[model samples]
Target: MSGNLADGERAGAARPCLEIACDESGSDGENLTGGNTDVFAHASVSLSVTAAAAAVRETRDRIRSPAEEYKANHLLREKHRAVLEWLLATDGPIHGRARVHLMEKTYFVVDRAVSLLLDDPEGAVTLFREGRRTFGEEGWRAFLDAANRLLRVRPNGDPVEIFYGTADSLARAHPGTDAARILERLAATRPRAESYRAGCADGPPLIPVLNPLLPAIVRTAALWSGDGRPVTLVHDRQNMLTPDRIAWIEQTARRAGVGLAGVRLVVARDDARVQVADFLAGIARKIASDELNGRADPALTALLRPYVDPASVWGDARSRALLADPVAG
Candidate 1:
């Protein structure tokens, strides 16, 4: 299926905007660490808007799967290595090239943020839902302070253990306040910072998975839209792009001095370009996972390295360095 805007709309559209098709793997916002997958990945492939429609049709013609829809993981499992090699090849319909950013869940104290919020449920939930949204360390600190003020604790109870009794006490003590409202707000806001924390004594503070992913996507958009056209992003349907995450992406892009004309989420089966991105992202995810597990596949690495964008590999500088010099590290 085509991903480009229709002919009638092109005249009104921005002059030089780039259209990007993206896909992801191993993304579970709430269960980043507890889930089976540890690494969260987002991969984007960009193309000039002028070429997008044709490219989508052409790419779809190349798929050999019997299934009505195509997915990256499926191809990797069933097809010969050449199928992946061909997809990532320079001659493929993908015009702008592929870039991927991944975050390893273990590198940061993944559970600290959520656990902290859980401990001070009343305070944590209040700030998360009511406090002005912020990013990085500065934002997290402000949230914590705001949340602490809303809680009542004994001298020994640091976070004020929140339970049924605590809720009842809070409701009785503050007749005007709604304890149920607080609980509802907390449930809604918890996932916003589920993978983050104010501080982690064992490791660096948690960077929400989306923080890195959005920036990387924006950078790619900037590169593709250098000609003065706005950028439009299209991605496969996934949980990572929840309303809060989308807000975070736009906010983050603004902070980074980047612009996105539009962001579209579509089913992979309905969009050929996203299917192509899925294939590429799937390959990258597998390779990265293998490297992390110390089961590097030299043949596969050698085949795919030439297709990878040097700038948009995994997030860690060390991982990039290792990918560059696998034997040395």
Candidate 2:
């Protein structure tokens, strides 16, 4: 699997460009709070179409499942544990060619709220890291719930009213507490919400903090473009990547000093590389979710460690500990 262009093609280029296939799992758009899945995993793979197809064919031969399309679930069943281990092994086809960004949904909401509502987002994040120890679990839960509601964009509701109402409810529920103080600070940012509403009234509605996919895509582009090379991403077709959103992603990447050549959308079934990425993403999400729930399989965890991106948006101490574990590497 390689991303190198032909020498003739490279001759006229200012810098080398690599093209990679991408797919995601557990994507519920901006519905972070009421979404079906708690984890979002986006995967990118550098494999060529032929190489990816061969890998898939080999896996299918090993599993011998009758299904027309292979998915992560086929590899996850207990009966196919050996095949799963082999697929994720360091010596496997995807070893160094893949990357996955796994985010815990609740944590993402908290992070977004802090960034949007607080003056010192970093300080607020550090304080919130103490979790139930600093603010009682119930109080913390209430704050997160309120924040999620305030940030979401509804088709028919007044966002400004939702903002103040959410903040007021939290203050009433947990008066004089740390959580309430946070909500008070958030209420002070009512002007920001008003600005958002004004902007929405003028143009397409914007919920900057709701969707996690944009940031994830930016980070993935940065990772693939680490050598100062431009990256062209081939992704599974998704409704969220509208023309405006794709332009935003490209502009954001440029601002961050990453050279993103372009983004191309294709049906996963038509593209073998995208299919391979789909499998990797789905499996990674399930494994990460299991780890979050304290039901991780040790062997699977070890196999998955190499592909987990270090900058993934995980906000729990257990998640940090998992990343720090030398044995898993």
Candidate 3:
């Protein structure tokens, strides 16, 4: 195992090599409202398997419990604060960077294709016109509400400009055109709109976990791929994420031109590195949930914020910049 890592590192001189351990929290998937966890967070750390295992082992020993199991949930207690502090400490021996993708489930329940709409200016205009005609002023208000939400929250670049420009152009072009006609035009020309129409029969297909998961992978890979070395990812196992999904992620990476060495799955208990990933994932979920509820714990926020890759963390300026990157597009 050490030899493999060494080989990877040496090869990385020509192309960087990154070993990633990943874990998730609040992953109830399509059944978001049915679960206690209202957010989904995919967290990862970039480090060799050996170093990450050592870090986890060292932290577990510091906790000083004879129990064989040590999970992120255990660290929520006051006594386990040291474990969190140690893992995120700059001088700590963890020897890696941490990044997480946070999805507020409620936002999705409100509108699953928010990102799609943001990218589809024509769709936004069509919805706005239809909404106004169907429910009078109230309907237009609601459509605008949803659209504004997407514009404000989406990581995509300069959404306000795109949204306003498209909407204003539509209003001017159609003038007093009938809402039904506008819908027909949108259905004919807007591929996303057409796709949604075709798929609506299936009840707006459940937003796959991979939607958020893939973005996280892309962002992380880009951040760590400074030297163009291959990135190898190992994610904590989930029954729902079958082999097909793994294959899809790999294929997507290939299409995106990401140098992916491999993708592996493992049980958290079997891999100490994955346990460290669990800790980061759990913390991210907590912070995102707290911010959503307007009850962010300052101390917890303070502890994790420094270690978090601001460019990858949702809602941060650095993350917005990443969103603007064509590669992410």
Considering every candidate listed, which one attains the maximal lDDT? Answer: 2
Ranking by lDDT: 2, 3, 1
lDDT of 3 by residue, 1-329 (tens): 11134443564255445677788888654444445886677777766578878887787778877778776776666788877777766677642366666665544332343345334444443443354555466534433443333323222344344434444444554556554344334333345533444454455333352245655656555555544567888878776557776676677777878777777888888887788888888876776577556676767665555445544433233333322222321
* Overall local distance difference test of candidate 3: 0.57
lDDT of 1 by residue, 45-150 (tens): 7654445446545445655556665566654764455666666666755522655555564332222333344555344334333322323345333333333322
Q: Order candidates by TM-score, high to low.
A: 2, 3, 1
Worst 10 residues of 3 by lDDT: 320-329
Name the lDDT value of residue 154 in candidate 1: 16
- On TM-score, the stronger of 1 and 3 is 3
Candidate 1 lDDT score at position 136: 32
Reference-based TM-score of each model: 0.56, 0.86, 0.64
lDDT of 2 by residue, 3-101 (tens): 455667656567667888999999887678667888999999998889999989988999999999999999999999888888899888899898888
Residue 174 error, candidate 1, Å: 46
Poorest 10 consecutive residues by lDDT, candidate 2: 320-329
Best by TM-score: 2
In model 1, which regions exceed 4 Å deviation?
1-15, 48-63, 108-228, 240-244, 306-318, 324-329
- Listing every candidate in turn, what is its Cα RMSD in Å to the true structure after a full C-alpha superposition? 13.8, 3.5, 9.2
Cα misplacement distance, residue 234 of candidate 2 (Å)? 0.5
